[model samples]
Target: MSHQPDERQLSLNAFLHDTGHHEASWRHPESGAERIGDIAWFQDIARKVEAAKLDAVFLADGPAWWGTGHRPSNNFEPITLLTALATVTERIGLISTASTTFYEPFNLARLFASLDRISGGRAGWNIVTTFSEDAAYNFGLDGVPSHEERYARAQDFIDVVTKLWDSWEDDALVVDRESGDYVDTSKVHAIDHVGPYLKVRGPFSAPRTPQGRPVYVQAGSSNEGRAFAARNAEAIFTAHQTIEDARAFYDDIKSKARALGRNPDHVKVRPGISPFIADTTAEAEELSQYFNRLTVPAYGLTQLEKMAGTSLRHLELDERVPVEVFGGAGNVLDNNRSRRQVVANIVERDRPTLRELLHRLAGGRGHNVVAGTPVQVADTIQEWFEGGAADGFNVMPPLYPQLLDAFTGQVVPILQDRGLFRTEYAGTTLREHYGLPRPDSQYADEPALAVGT
Candidate 1:
């Protein structure tokens, strides 16, 4: 048997949150959360990621506000924001999360395809079934849909959207000035899609995008979520606090994809990692502690309340959390179901006091949090890549330009020196960065079919 090629050429993406990855990043003096309403700030971040030869810059979004006024909220819409970023950046992939449960397939397809075209084929769509009741309310619904139902709808939604994207052939447009023919009508086919959640008729208004359909990404880690990723996602964003968990998830998703008759290498698994790098290990640890100290206890309690699906108002900050609050073994918490489970699992396994739990979650939920020197940080990334745990990582720097600068200036060079990452961009588009193929239109054979059949 032939030996498998090395998978050490890891792909890295910058997971851009409002201010930074640390929950208290906005409170830090160096962060730029004050410019939350400015598009230029986001564009600057995108340019930085591109300069570093990163595969993509991802924007996490929710349809409605889940956190109270105590924490930084998602202020800008992702599609529009990414579109603006695309105009300035030449190489970085721009990915934005949009909820299948709350959006029409036709509109989403149009928006993402437009971005891909504008960016010359560097757009990606992160598919999610919105989990918040607030999001449901905003969408004119009384409550959020059941988990199984949401996945079912998502499957259908993706089918319709992709079909629409493929409705027009690449050469559908024929600009013949003498003949006064702007487009070849015969080449354009109508996708009369009628599904359980959507009914869209005819060809897409926009032409085929640069990469055909934007790279499909998924971030859920549940059973249904894993199945969905195996079937559809080219890239996956996961949250795991430990190497053991990351490796398990990586193996499980790839194995599932293989069983489904897909090349497992086609699916890239990346876990969220927030690195707080400093000149020295002690300095990094101090910085981590500083952020931890700045965390608002009231906000943490409120977040826990949401995660636990039960109120923690009566409990003191120093009190030990009872497993019974998580509804014991038989209890089901469905508020933010996945997050609730993550927090519950941590509480049950570690049995930390309420204060300790808050500290652990201060750095953007359960994403791996590390504070160290540049070399140590690079070592962590290398170990994870070489050990079959991740493709690369979703870099979530704890602060703004400072943290981002440290990673790019300090850690990136180390990665390049080890022959793990590129010093300069290899291609012009996000597809080039990720080594993904540009998709062919399903309607490319219209004229041939019309004549033969």
Candidate 2:
């Protein structure tokens, strides 16, 4: 083990969407909606992030169609797209979302291992337990499983995947040509994992990857989600509309991680922030409103219905959203089931009109939305970064390429000037860049498990 003097650097990841996080961004003049199918455009965007020296670039994925007719919902499978991105960019870490509810542990392990090998160790997995009933139908299930059942399966899934990732020791591959022995067989071990939801027996075919395993990332913030992340996740992508809420969530995750006998610092909490940037705060607000105006009322209402888990068609779009309309998010103490709590908080705090609420959420889907100048945006980031509210941010630009460029070109320089973010790449692998130590294989000393004899 090695130690170094503490100097905290903010980690930023570019969350790529078709055009941007804004629901109507495709209608923006600066948007490259036509280039959504062009691989080179994505490659170019990835290059821009790499050049800015951000920590990583992330892609979100889902098996089911988004069921929305208004926005550009087309997407490439994150792994496939990121592989192409890996070829064009060198320093930026490539993270992809894959669901435990749908993927087998062994196959998922192999895919990410290959990605790690191909990218020279820059790979991260955003683990998700899919709860979409539409997604369940795709897999032949009548409906989504209970949350507890899905989480239990997720735990077993991660255990099997990690064991597979660790089955082959780092030094197992020894090319002794004269001896005609390509590997040291004694170093390889089988992980026989048996669980209520998953069972796997394996001496993984591939050798240990550069970082031991892809960085474990979790994306939910429900009570169960918090516990799972404490026990497993290295990084957490969360959603909170206020700094107070963000701080509360941050404290809870760290305390829980510490209580579980893990280093609190190891679990990085990053809330999503979608910024609308301009030369001045007023101009930035106008830009944000411009995107909001382009939104179709029908689409926003549909989205609201999904989040609230109830039909809101009876309400007028121009009127203030009733507090009681949020009947399905389980109230304030209902365990934070969905984005209902976020929406509830927004209504309770600001009393935004239905249209205004839609526009607010249209930017980042319960994530914080800020419209400001470069310095102001940088200030918000610095405030959260240093105020025990966040370790970093998931930079969700409302418009792709243009807004991303604005962030990288305008805000990033300010952050760098203030000594909050990196001005250059300091490491090659994602683990190194994120300040995490490379992990040793799980079979460093123990013999292979022999089971079901």
Candidate 3:
């Protein structure tokens, strides 16, 4: 008998930024930058996503400000910000970025565990190894650690954090009224992890959370990144400009996981998608162009400088970028290690002038930017899903409220009708939302099997 495909398996996440995905989204007349500091703004967005039953609302973070201070400099801290957001929304998953390189494993573990309990099991941790040298300076480091060193530290960080999370067994918490015992001491264990980069001593103060541990999400796509995620990540956020690239990444990662004795389906690969929608294809195209035109060339050039890791101050706005300027993107890919290859690929393929390149990078750094009517946008999403290129997507609106409203109002309903998206939330926790199992504590003892001699 042929196995039937699972129909209720599409996963969708809203990738929340200061204003939106477009670099110049804040400058859009309808967009609101006034409330970037307001919790209510994010709360309202989260509520809308919950109403649509999105799997999660993700927040990208960096330790230091990479952009010019002229716009909105990096504003809020993610963990504290998400804690506030959790109180206002009911069901949508909360995923926040925390760099493994910058934080202590025990503290990071405690924060996420607390968040999971506070949010009633709707927390997820987006694991990232810090990349920016600016971030290194902020952390009081002389220079950024090598990519290999960062990933090595990351592996140990995850190991220690997982140990901390597992320190308190599921049954460890026992509020015995008569005995006045809050916890069974025998059931709790300490993890004495002493790796090269981390030396964390456990049992954590927090008990086992609602989901055992927060769902682990990863975003890096380098070889080291892929290996790390294959070994540990439950869901992966990736960037891809084409179906072929997405498929290749998905297949490679899943295959790697299977080779490591993991269930490949457990590692969901979702790419970033920024869609500009309108009543018609022409109108949508015009809207996308309008956003591109609104982009400040100076701001774009500065961003390009950061990506190219060289000064572009002397270059004219309309001049062509030299092919040799990038220094071949080091072994692991330079600039932003995660995106340098992408930028290089774009430059090598298109050979566009500096002005044109600025426009191209304006839409969320090479993520697939689609401009079309609701039907067209939905068709593209459906195609990517059905074609096995993506499990779903990280929806990036070009601008807030207006862009999100357009997508949630117009495109979401179409997806719901087609059975490509959920009409109502079926699960309470982030793990459930992604169809991932709550990981059992590695410290738990297993019963021995009886066998005949």
lDDT: which candidate is best?
2
Q: List the residue pairs that clash in candidate 3.
A: none
lDDT of 2: 0.88
Q: Candidate 2 — which residues are off by over 4 angstroms?
A: 1-6, 327-334, 449-453
Which number leads on TM-score? 2
**1 versus 2: better lDDT goes to:** 2
Compute each candidate's TM-score over C-alphas: 0.92, 0.96, 0.93
Rank the models by TM-score, top first: 2, 3, 1
lDDT of 1 by residue, 48-107 (tens): 888888899999899887657777788789999999998898888999999999998888
Report the lDDT of model 3 for residue 232.
92
Instruction: Evaluate model 2: give its TM-score.
Output: 0.96
Cα RMSD of all models vs. native, in order, equals 3.7, 3.2, 4.6
User: Alpha carbon lDDT of residue 29, candidate 2?
Assistant: 84
Where in model 3 is the C-alpha error above 4 Å? 1-5, 313-315, 326-336, 446-453
